[model samples]
Target chain A: MSKPFLSIENMTQTFPDGQGGTLTVFEDATFGIDKGEFVCILGHSGCGKSTIMNILAGLAEPTSGVVKMDGFEVSGPSLDRGVVFQNYSLLPWLSTLKNVTFGVKARYPDWSKAKVEAHAREYLAMVGLEGDVVHRKPSQLSGGMRQRVSIARAFANHPKLLLLDEPFGALDALTRGTIQDELLKIWGGTEQTVFMITHDIDEAILLADRILLMTNGPFARVAESVEITIPRPRNRTDIVEHPNYYAIRNHLVQFLGQRSKELAGQQSGGEPQSPTRVVIDKTGPAPDPEPTTKPQLRAVND
Target chain B: MLDNLSTNQRAAVLSVVMLVVGLLIWEAAIPAQKAASELTEYERLTGGGAPKAGVPPPSQVLAKAWEQLSNPFYDAGPNDKGIGIQIGYSIYRVLTGYILAALIAIPLGFLIGMSQVAYKAFNPFIQVLRPISPLAWMPLALFIIQDSEASAIFVIFICSIWPMLINTAFGVAGVRQDWVNVARTHELNGIKTAFMVILPAAAPTIITGMRISIGIAWLVIVAAEMLVGGTGIGYYVWNEWNNLDLTSVIFSILMIGVVGMLLDSAFGFLQRAVTYAE
Candidate 1:
């Protein structure tokens, strides 16, 4: 990929045991994210998605290898990398305007007070908050409103890279859909690179330019990189009409299901697992997505 | 809001009636002789006769209060200085001591809260000093400062510092790690992050501590003044007892109660003003 904007190479993380040995969480893990790419890392529980994110954020150190951003070694947290936490980490004492302004003032210290405030207000409005509502504290706002403010604060800085650790995992399905739309709209408006961790297959399929599927446990690695060719301005309601959408979704489902089966087989060496893979036209007529066809698993004879 | 208040008002009115009835029963239960004893004591002062035994009236004390309250700034006699003058002197002492205490205590508390090493070093000293009564400080204060007014102020200072200090420390310590992360992610450096994030986040708890400090300050002031024998409502009550002016003594007691209530209310209002919920 001509040296992606961000590159992680041979990253291995090990936690030291009190007894002289080390527990390896991931080994030789590697990935690269290009500029303006929306990448979702998906895995089952305990796959070290958060661990990898923390490593990239410089909150935690990896045991081996390096993470480079724009061809510079990642050291500590930087203004170049903005993070939106899943918990909506809005400081309660500050009003929405002040909260967003806090980020702007820090990143752009040379900017005058009026300029900082105007920038904050513009971002708040971009996230759909009106002027009257901007004055209210986080406690006074609803859950969704708080998350919106969080997004505004993160995006306001226009950081070179944005990391979201399951930002919408805590919301309800309906709220999740609404927020997903908002997120897409906001992403469409910006050129920042995004890497998000998600458990929802649909979310990964809908939001990402590429979905990085991870294997289950201790030696977790990106098993597959699925490129989504779904057209631009893709609305979720109409996304199903894209022919490859069903095939790609089915492929991912089949991949995850088989990965689970392979692990189970490794433990017992029972059946010959054959995970069925769907190959369909990337540019062809779309059919109504069906739920009846359960993705069949095929064996990869390791 | 009006519609929401009807039931609340009904409950409040019911409680008021209950309180009034309880007071009436208390008044009725007092024996005639005891009532007369109370009035006789009241009568001994102000050169006013005791009320009828059955009903110990408030008019006579009210008149004495009015006499003291009117021209509240113009000293008419040695014992007849305006109530406002006395109250002003007391409030002045309290403000001087309390503000001084807050100024020192809050920042110190924040520092202690922020650093484990500082907290470990200073916490023992705070624990030891906090329990020593403000009244106990009175004797040391008198011996050192030598002036009753200064001693009284010093005692108030000692009494008020601990709550604010502890609260400030706790508030600062309890600020969320997530907020700190946000500040760091935004590239806010140490001092700026502390000011913009930590201080504001900890303010509610710190203010609550101040409220408690104020109430304690008011309570300690009366005792401090009484021990120091100064020109405050506390001293006024003690002086009347010396003069066997029981009515004046009771009046001073009422005045102390009212002033204490006002101080509490003032702090309560401040707490509300500063609070912003998450």
Candidate 2:
């Protein structure tokens, strides 16, 4: 296989467990995300999902491993990787448009002020933030709107990789659906590599090209890379109609519900633990897709 | 009629009534001045014709205010300067000292706030120095600076520095880690992050500190000027007392309170500007 666009090689993270023993949040975790792929890692709390996300974003370092993008080792935060934090970390003092422009200006310093502002307004528009709404500070916005501004800020920077730590975790179901759709639409246009962490199984299935299932900590490991074979434009309402949908969903549910705990706290014995690839396909030749899965079906040909 | 007014308007009306009532009570409480003819030979011989040194009525103080305020900037001689000129001198000293304090405090506060080692190291010194009265510094300042004017300003500076420095450090240290993480993820350089993120994040608290410092400086300036006794409103009050002109002294005291309120409200406006709801 070709080298992935972004790769974490044997990344381990441990903390002093307060009794002179080290707590291995996750050990010898190895993963690769292909370019233009939307990958999500789902595990219960204490599984070190956010730790891995922080490592990938270069906001934190792994205990004894490296993160690389485009074959360059990542040592610190860069414009190449943008993060949408879990709490919708938009600067409260800046208006929604200025928040986007803050990142845009940093990413493209040579760009003119007018260009930066226009670019900010455009991405904000994509997230359904426009006009007066864009001028409101984050505190003035609803939870969903704040998250949208955060997403707009990240996307405006055009980072090679976008790291989202449960972007929809704070939203209600309806708001989550709307923002998820907007995220998918924006991601479709940009084709930027994405790595996200979420606890929601349905959200993972709906958005990710592949789902990386992580076992629980203190010896957490990435156990499986489950491929979501549902074609785009996967509809929130209709993706379930696809034959591969429930099969993949059930496998994920079974893994997270049963196997995650069963496989928890296992040492890989100094071996780099990569996920076992599991692809579920129930389509026959010229398999039919539901008409509602439009924009268009990127059919996984059987 | 009062029921039709808004809360603020009603409160204002009540304030006016209280002021009038207070003035009427004050006017009535003063004993009638002894007639010059009723004074004994000894009192007359000792110049009892002059107004006795006592708390002047509000009406007398008001008349003095009108007289002094009419031509405040007249500088006839050293001890006999106008109220305007005296207030102007006091304001100059307060602002100069306050600005100098801010110049040193804010940047130093940021440094201390950003580093745990620096914060710990500076804490003892701040603790020791902050509590000493600004007036206490006057004697040492007089000896060292050797100029009363500079010494007065120095006293104001020393007095104002503590609140601003402590508050700034607190505010800067208290900036949310999430916001700093946002700056990190954006790849902002240290300076850029400080100016764009940390500064704005800490500004409200810093301004609060500044408000506190300005109030302290205003309070200290009066006392410092009294001790130094050169050209401030504090000196004017002292000089009026020495001359036994209680009307002028009361009027100067009223002027001092008005000026302090104006100074504080200026910072109040600034505090409101920088404040953001989290």
Candidate 3:
């Protein structure tokens, strides 16, 4: 198999618990995201999902292991890794347009001011914020609108990878749906590699090509990487009806509900194993039901 | 009667009414003139002929205010300048000192806020020095600088520096981590992040510090000028008091209040400008 475009190998993060003992947030977590692939990480709180995203973004260093993007070891924050924080971390003092322009200009300093502004506006328009709304400050905009600006800013930089830390966690259901669709539309146009962290299973199914489920922490590991086979241009309304949807959904729900807790109790001996990969197919015939252990499906013809 | 008005308007009307009533009572309480025939032999011997030596009536103070204001900037002589010139001197000193304090305090504040080591090292010194009165510096400043004008300016500087320094440090330290993370993700360097992200984020708090500083500076300038005995509103009040010109003293007091309010409101406007709802 070809080398993954973004690889996180055995990353462990620990903090001093102030009692002279080290508190391990997560340990020996391993995952890889391919180029132009959209991957979402699913975990309950305290599973170190944000810590993993922060490591990928280069905002924080893992206590051990490395994050590699485009074959280079990530060290610190760079424009090549764009981030969309859940709080819609737009510079509050800048107008929406200026905020986007600020990043665009930083990315392409040689570009003319007009060119930078035009590029920013284009991204803003892609996120459905156009005309006068772009001139308003984040304070003047609604919460959904602010998040849209943040997405626009991240996309406008044209980073090699986008790290979204629960980007829609704060939005209501309706707003989340709209922004998710907008994000997918934008992602479809660019084929951007994305690593997103979220607790929402439906959102993961809606946006990601693959979902990485993380077990509960202290020594948490990425327990499984569920490959989503839902076809492209997928609609939220129609996705659940796909034949593979229920199989994939049930597997994810079962993993999160019971398997996560069960795996957390099972102490692996040495270095943790890579997450098991599961593939779901809508048109393929079902394999014989194995009453012993979970059946691993055969690789499909792409 | 105040029911139809907004709260501020009602308060303003009440203030005016209270002022008028207070003035009438004051005018009535002090006899307009001493009864010349009822003067005691001791009063006659003591030459008590100084217009009864009472607080000047409101009408007299109002007349003096109009006269001084009509030619505020007139500079007949150092001691005989118009009220405007006196106030101008005081404001210039306050601004010069306040600006110098800002130049030193803001960058230093950023350093202190950004570094725990610096904060720990400097906090005790700041705590000890901040509470000492600005005028308390006047004697040493005069001894070293040996210039009354500079001493007055130095006093204003001492008075205004603490608030701005503390507030700026607090504001810079309090910038949201997420915003800083955004700056880092954009690959902004430290300088750009400071100017573009941290500065704007901390501006409102810094302005609040500035507001407090200006109010204190204004207050201290009056006292400083009084101590130095130079040409300022504060000095003018002292000089008028020495001359027993109660009307002029009252007029200068009103001017000081008005100017102080203007200085405060200017900072208030700036604070609002930088303030973000979030």
In candidate 2, clashing pairs total 0
Overall lDDT per candidate, in order of appearance: 0.80, 0.90, 0.89
Candidate with maximal lDDT: 2
Docking class of 3: high
Candidate 3 chain A weakest lDDT stretch, 10 residues: A293-302
- Better DockQ candidate (1, 2): 2
- What is each candidate's DockQ, to 2 decimals? 0.55, 0.78, 0.81
Better of 2 and 3 by TM-score: 2
Against the hidden reference, what TM-scores do the models get? 0.83, 0.95, 0.94
Candidate 1 vs 3: which has more lDDT: 3
RMSD of each: 7.0, 4.5, 3.5
- Tell me the tens digit of each residue's lDDT in model 1 across A274-302: 22222244675555254354332222222
The residue pairs in collision within model 1 are A139-B278, A273-A298, A273-A299, A274-A297, A274-A298, A274-A299, A275-A297, A275-A298, A275-A299
* lDDT (10s digit) by residue, model 2, range A94-168: 888899999998999999999999999999999998889988888999999999999999999999999999999
Candidate 2 segments exceeding 4 Å error: A285-302, B36-51
TM-score of 3: 0.94
Per residue, candidate 2 scores C-alpha lDDT tens digits across B79-161 of: 89999999999999999999999999999999999999999999999999999988888889989999999999998899999
Backbone clash pairs for candidate 3 read: none
